[model samples]
Target: MRLSNRNKTPFYSFIYSLAGIILVLWLIAFILEINKFDVLGDKSWVLLFIPTVMLLFLYLSGRPIFEYDSDGEALNFRNCHILFLLSQNNAKDEFPKYKLIKYNVVNVLMFSTLYVYVSSKKSNVVILKYDLTFMTKKEIKDLKFSLNKVVKTNGETSKDDNTVID
Candidate 1:
């Protein structure tokens, strides 16, 4: 199973573009004095904060593009921010299916993250994290089901390996 937000890229990009346009319009209005903001009077600077806050909120909620591949013998995960050139933040991980021990999904306000634990040769466990903020509810549910299936298979295999036959 492979899941990605490749199709929804346009929608997310439009939202980001809208925020930028709003900020630019506000800046132009403030600089040229096109219209007077009577409510803010002497503290007209507060109006600029609205667009800034909107940009931040949208970025926090929709910046990352997540991909998960559970094909073949390994699990592959990738998370790359939409504005990759600006932020230069990307995470990628691949590990054999048998090494997967457990996983966790944490949701906080407008953000979400997935933590995967894998058994290591030298260390007891290796943890990898992926961003899940922009994933839909159905995607999240499918992801949970995939991880659970892998963990159950791992447990069963471990049990079989530990059996002693006389």
Candidate 2:
């Protein structure tokens, strides 16, 4: 089944607006500085270097991958890893038997990024590191609901099929 393309996040637009403002201001400042400084008179064009690099990084990192499905399991994700996997069985004892989620967020400016993960059977709290931006509150809530539904429906269907085998 195809997931709906509904973004309920109220703050996403605001955040994007803020980023735009910051980028614009930075570019203007760079231009004004070039006019006053003769230090790089021969290479004043370097003033546009920083903002150009930033915009390029943002464009690459912001590409969104929203859905994944394989072998009867499916996942709906946002602002996370480009690739992921889901399964009902775990080879290790420490691994829990429930939905597993993992993703990486690349932070270009800082020269660093973070990987985050969650499990449905464990506490609702997420495990994360590094300073990474995420989807708005509403988007996260909706994504969680969608993932939970996928897991529940798959589990129920498997149970019904197993009963017939016995």
Candidate 3:
């Protein structure tokens, strides 16, 4: 199975584009006036500054397009910012399904992260983090289902192989 947020790319792109337009308009207005209004006019700089800061924050923390594939023996995951131009935190991972031990999803404020625990050759467990902020509720549900299925299979296989009949 393969899952991705490519379908919503246009929507996210539009939002960022709109924010950019607003930031530009505010800059132009501020430069033209410099000092014009008489009410809250002295603090008009606030109007220009607030949106600029907000846009910056949104861009920095913007949602990334996420992709997951479980078609073969290995599980693949990839994440890259919707606006790839300024994308700095792109992440990708591929590991065998049998290595998957457990997974957890943490939601804080407006961000969600997926923590995958896998057994490594040298280490008992390795943790991998993936951003899930952009995934829809249904997508998240399906992802949880897939992870749970993998964990359950791992547990059952380990149990069966370790059992000794006398």
Candidate 4:
């Protein structure tokens, strides 16, 4: 269950591209205002602050947020779920020991949209959009089914009222 990925290079690249675009736009604006310093108005500079904050947020969010163990436990972003079990029982043969789940930008966008839609309807499931790219759609669905089965099996055993060993 260990999730491994090529270090955050690609993730960093995406962030850099996003931030660079914002920065370049800001720079161009600044350059254009070189001669007309006051043309942007005192409050005009405030506009750049939005992008600055957004850049910071993007940088922070883009960092690796989860790492899974071979045992199926995961260390989620913020590490509160370090002990949380993402899967039950170690993976069997033909299954990868570690799967790297990177959240693709497109998936992130979709997740965000879905989150908003679901939340508006007050759905019980809290969908966290981070690190969603690591697993393909099929893989994610399969993992969910497997974990549910494991939980159900364990739950039934715990609920049994009487058990005797010969």
Candidate 4: deviation at residue 110, Å? 6.5
lDDT of 3 by residue, 13-116 (tens): 88888888988888877776665644555776876887788787776564568899988899998887877676777778899999999999998887888999
Query: Candidate 4 lDDT (Cα, whole model)?
Result: 0.42
lDDT of 1 by residue, 1-166 (tens): 8999878878877877888899999887766553654555667786688898998787666446889999999999988776655456578789899999999999998689898999999999999888888898899999999999999999999999999999
lDDT of each: 0.84, 0.46, 0.84, 0.42
Worst 10 residues of 1 by lDDT: 31-40
The per-candidate count of clashes, in order, stands at 0, 0, 0, 4
The global Cα lDDT (0 to 1) of model 2 is 0.46
List candidate 3 stretches off by more than 4 Å. 35-39, 60-62
Candidate 2 lDDT, tens digit per residue, 1-166? Answer: 3332225333444544565677788677677767665576667666577666765665444423233222233333333332222212111112232444544545465443334454654587465442233444454455446546655665776688788543
The list of candidate 1 runs beyond 4 A from truth reads: 33-39
Per-model TM against the reference: 0.88, 0.37, 0.86, 0.42
Backbone-clash count (model 2): 0
Error of 3 at 139 (Å): 0.8
TM-score of 1: 0.88
Cα lDDT of model 4 by residue, 1-166, tens digit: 4443435546645765777688779867766665467586666666577778876665334323333333543222221111124323222122221222212224454231111001113544333333434334654455445444444554565567367667
Q: Candidate 2 — which residues are off by over 4 angstroms?
A: 1-37, 41-46, 64-134
User: Of the candidates numbered 2 and 4, which has the greater TM-score value?
Assistant: 4
